[model samples]
Target chain A: MGNADSLLQAEGLSRDYEHYNAVQDYQLTLKRGEILGLLGPNGAGKSTTLRMLSGTLAPSRGAISIKGIDLLQQPRRAKQSLGYLPDQPPLYFDLTVEEYLGYCGRLRGIRKADVEPAIQRVIKTCSLEEVQKRLISHLSLGYQQRVGIAQAIIHEPDLVILDEPTKGLDPIQINAIRDLIRNLAEQHAVILSTHILSEVEAVCNRVQIINQGQIVHESQLGIQEPDKVFFQLHLARPPETAQIEALQGVESVIAQDKGRYLISVENAQAGLQIVTSAIIQNNWGLLGLCPQHESLEQTFMQKVFQEDRP
Target chain B: MIGLITRFEYRRLFLSPLAWTLIAGLQFILALLFLVFLENFITELQPRLALIDDAPGATDTVITPMLIWAGILWLAVIPLLTMRSFSEERLYQRQALLMSSPISISEIVMGKYLGLLLFLATALSPTLLTAVSLSTGTQLDWGKLIAGFMGLYLMLASFSAAGLFLSTLSRQPAMAAALSYGLLALLFVFYITGKTQGSESVLFIYLSHFGHFLNLSSGLVYSSDILYFLLFSTGFIILTIQRLDSDRRNG
Candidate 1:
């Protein structure tokens, strides 16, 4: 079931192979104007989930609703609201960029009268103006990617799903695409899947890390305040672990060898003040204190690799 | 939506040089055959033209044979033309685009079928026009010409449908073409068996398309013959749609 405010909602989504699950019990909800990034390694079910969302693949069990329309029951109507760019851009090399985009617009059920204007809008938005007349096969890789995006958004769908939108591109083109995605999210609920973490930090507001066909971690990107903060401190004479744990903002304190203490603080700024004051009052000489953050890269690696540990 | 797909397919086929080249080559070959047959008729059958009350004229002696030759040509060419319908999409991984679109599988199959039919009709037009032009110089039977054309059109439609169906089964266009040829050859082989003992095996003669196609070409329009063509084309088209639906479900 979709919430009134949700632009897209999926529940209990699962796709199964003969003996393995490709994706299992996946849930997602995206509000209008929100960009959700799906991050995962190869064969981690990001593409499979996106394919199901785009109505191209049937899930073994799931319910997907786009703008209050059920995907399985009314696929055509539901798909009318979706725009998808597969991991490999599905392009017709023989057609010109303009012609290809026009076909895409009509393929999405855009009105005949509206297809021309829609093509023009996507072409301009994707920066495909200069090569609109050129055959897709003749264009450079960057331009082909642009044309791929143009085709996806030509129908002005409410939900845009992109898989590896910037898989292979120079830094300059990547930046341009990042900006274009930001603009697209202003009007549509966008779900972007990529292996690149920087892309999520640069364009996505929220990120989900998928591992072994399941979402293992999800968090907001570029938030001002961290959810949990860690600190590594060395002391000449360390206090007891309970003494540190008793501090106002301290969540946990673990003793390390060689007179080191590891503290988890719920609020780093306030905890820094309390811990420091307590250390000074107790006369336990604070050798060094460094605040540590769990970056997205670390979180991703931990979640993906932690399962491998016995 | 189906109309849009059909129109889009037609434009794509027209823009491709392969379709044009095939049409031009067929026209050239038919023209040469036309002249050679017309010369043969003038020399051998001119004196006997008025001997019987009803005798074979230009439409029979020349046009019908020419159409049969064109029919044989289509056996090879239609497979090439229709091989790319879905096979190329699979080869380039562009099936995602069409499969992801909101259109139903039936619409996609019908669109490709109609598009290829239009292209085949355009390619066969020049040869038909040449046969029509024979009336200006000598007596011609419009009924026989039309029946022959209807037979040719039906055969092309069936061949193209089978080829399109084969295309959905493989990603390699050449392999699709080969499979389509194999199917047509199977049909022809069955027809050849029936020919060995004319009318002895009613089942074999009726099962093969050759007897029915020849029946129609000789100005015999049986409802059964038309039904055979319709069922042949529709059966393959339905199979193609079902194949796509299964791929979506399974993949």
Candidate 2:
């Protein structure tokens, strides 16, 4: 099913290599201003899926519609709204940054008059102003990556797909690129694949973990409902699990080692108030209390490695 | 889109030292050959030609042979020029930029083809100037010179088209160049075999590029020869487009 306002939609996408299938029945629907992080291990078809979505690689058996235009039937029109950066940055090393971006702008069908402004805008956005006139081969890896991103967005496409935008970079460069991606999400729907788990947690509002050429897990990030809250509690005076479970909004309590307890509750705010008061009244000294959600790293590990245990 | 790609490719061609080196080297070789041809015409053929009526002029004695030599030189040079057209892009993974840019395969192929053709035309300019210089000292056959240049250009176009197709088939530029040289040399072999075999193998001669090129370079603009070049270039260009389309489809 396609959404009218969606920027990208694909159904039943599959890619078959010579001896085996690389991707199978991949599906995605991205609305405007949404960033979808695709996370997968090595050889998990993330690149293949992104390549198909960006109209660079054709799918064997599926339909993809970009801004409601069928990619297979009307690829040129559909691709006008799409931009992609593959795993390796597709750069002509001989051209300068400004020249390359200008070419990309023209290639993306920006008018001659608008190409300069588009180049300027992306140059400023990607913080490439100082090195704009330098040859791309002379730039460092970080700047090269920024230039790659600049070209992808120079045309102001509705959808931008990037494969491993920050695979090899220092922490500072990674943060800078993350900030750029976040800024891009303000206007364009972004789909990026990364090996870093925290990258998804930091930048993406939604994430999908793919393994074995199929999406194994998908969830919204940092948007948990109040009812599904878990709190880790440490008390100086030990208490039985039954006593904590008796608190009014508390769903269950599991005791951990060293006076620590993991408690699930119906509502986070009400449960915190009830549990704190109960602990004070019972004279069980509260050592530490904090809301603890399941980290994405654990989920990724389980979803990726669990399936491998045949 | 094609114009944008063509312009960018043309500009990029000039940015690399390889193009400049090839152009300079070709000019040096051709200029030396022009002198040798000029010296031979003056010292050995001038008196013999004076005794005969309707004798071969400078255009026939000097320009035609030089043009033929230029054509043969380009058979090797065009492959080096066209080898990087698609092969380098595919090797560096830069082809995705174009493939995803809302441009069709034909536009990409034609854009690259025209860009290389433009550069080859530029490389051919020195030879034309050398031939035109003869007009200052003697009567020059302008028709034959133009016909010879046209034939050489068409032959280069066919060589580049085939080279572009071979570039699409390989990721390494060296491999593409070798394949192109092999294919062009095979055509030359066909020409030699057809000439030696005489009337028995008309098809081979017709199929060979040299036969049509020779017809055009001899001040003969046969419609069949022009059509053969047109069909040969268009056929290879179409094959390049189909190969790229299949690469995208099956990738």
Docking class of 1: medium
- DockQ of the candidate models in sequence: 0.66, 0.85
lDDT by residue for model 1 (B95-166), tens:
888877898889888988888888778788898889989988977888888999999899888878889999
Model 1: how far residue A198 lies from native, Å:
2.6
Least accurate 10 contiguous residues by lDDT in model 1 chain A:
A219-228
Misplaced by over 4 Å in model 1 are: A231-291, B198-200
Interface alpha-carbon RMSD, every candidate: 1.1, 0.8
CAPRI quality of model 2 = high
lDDT of each: 0.88, 0.90
Scored against the true structure, residue A168 in model 1 reaches a CA lDDT of 75
lDDT of candidate model 1 versus the reference: 0.88
Sliding window of 10 residues with minimal summed lDDT for model 1 chain B? B197-206
Best-fitting candidate, scored by DockQ: 2
A1-310, model 2: which lDDT tens digit per residue?
A: 4678888999999999989898999988898888999999989999999999988899999999998899989989988998889988899999999999999888887999999989999999888999999999999988898899888999989999999998666799788889988888888899999878989999999999999899999998876574678989999998888988888999988899989999888888877889999999999999999888878899999999987899
Quote each prediction's TM-score.
Answer: 0.91, 0.97
